[model samples]
Target: MNYSKKIFCQPLLWVIALFLISSGCQPKTEEQATAENRETDTESKLEPLTTENVVEVLTSYEKEHADSLVLISTRHGDIKLRLYSETPLHRANFVRLTKAGFYDQGEFYRVVKGFAVQGGDSDTRTMKNGAYKIPQEFNPKYIHKRGALAMARYGDERNPEKESSSHNFYIVQGEPKTVQELRAFEAKHNMKYTPQQIKLYTTIGGEPSLDQEYTVFGEVIEGMDVVDKISEEQVDGQNWPHTIVPHKIKTINQ
Candidate 1:
């Protein structure tokens, strides 16, 4: 979080390369712990997502301040994330769902080494009953750098606006790139990267190709070693972990 204030800036089939993609435990602030407690208290009054009410529910959540942090405890390790206030819809939706215990038994079903890791499918019928979609929450301020937390969505053909899936999400764990690689990307994609972007991607690493295609509302604050470990774990043909990798995402209340 001490990095410069410079803002750097996918998809709705999320190929994830099917071949390409890719935590730590940390303490929480007193204020954050209190906020999380308040959120849990109000969870009972919140309703599940549904086709008829997805838009309305998202709108309601979008208007609220985004000041919460959450923990993604996986078999590999715990990843602490700071939700970005700029993408209010995505941030609010994530916070609300985390507080509801909707992600208790979720697994990191999709993992692409050196690319990203995805989860949030509560396979139970109860979660399916609450299945819904939310509109895209794209913003120029958020980028898909390594450790970025973004929502998963279907393809552009089926979802032109690139609306996000209500529950599924991913965290980028991309590899570093050289200026030459970045230039080639620019030539292919017809986009330019700011100097700050070039510096980050060439230094810390990230999936720059995914920028703007998906909504990135947060980033990991600690335990990135866990992310690296998970990315290197064994996976099946579909990129799912060969061994079960349990995940439990909840609001970090200290």
Candidate 2:
């Protein structure tokens, strides 16, 4: 497989594993993956947050919604996104972070061309600001189409509920697929997408297998080329950009 196709396939494999996790299919020990991730992210005892704290924050922001367009200013270019009103919890968290300048100067640390460019954690800023989880806000109205803005979270072993991370997010740069390709995914992964979703995957393109697994709360309204460019940038062994590609996000009056 070529580089872009290879990158796209890796995530689908993970999604398949997630599907299995839901249906009593065991692929890898969730314990191993969770342990590795924990080692990668050393515990920070400072300003630790609780579920109650997160719930309280969610309650206080019930009325908060994205009335203005949000722009993620990146080194490649600005990516304008429209947060979906249907997914209020995820939308509110994104809007709150953008307004607070939490994403400013953050680098797109993980970039996989034709897959995603992930950011929202610049030097552990979320932890310093008191990080918390948001309940899964999966809406059928949203799918992982190219330019889709979605939150990233832990693997199924640790996050069985599919809870989303409070800060980290990604923009999809997925490629279009044929009906045959999608059917193979359905058979291998033991999941299915709606006919409309399948149509979207075969046309405009997206990681269709990720539809219900991740929280896709928004989509790029402009500068999709920039997101694509970021995905294609040179990266290190870890898929992190060779050089910093910073993202500065803010709320703009429409």
Report the C-alpha lDDT of model 2 over 10-58, residue by residue, as the tens digit. Answer: 2333344322222222233334434434544434333333445766665
Model 2 compared with the native: what TM-score? 0.76
Question: TM-scores across all candidates?
Answer: 0.77, 0.76
* Predictions in order: lDDT: 0.68, 0.68
Per-residue lDDT over 1-254 for candidate 1, one digit per residue giving the tens place of the 0 to 100 score:
11111001023234434433221112233344334435554444446465578777766866763546898898788989998877777888887877666677466766777888877753331332144567888776677888999987756656677777776788899889999988887786567888998888998899877777788889999978888888887876556677767788877654
> How far is 223's C-alpha from truth in model 2 (Å)?
0.5
Q: After superposition, how far is residue 204 of candidate 1 from its true place, in Å?
A: 1.4
Q: Each prediction's Cα RMSD?
A: 11.1, 7.4
Q: Per model, how many backbone clashes are there? A: 16, 0
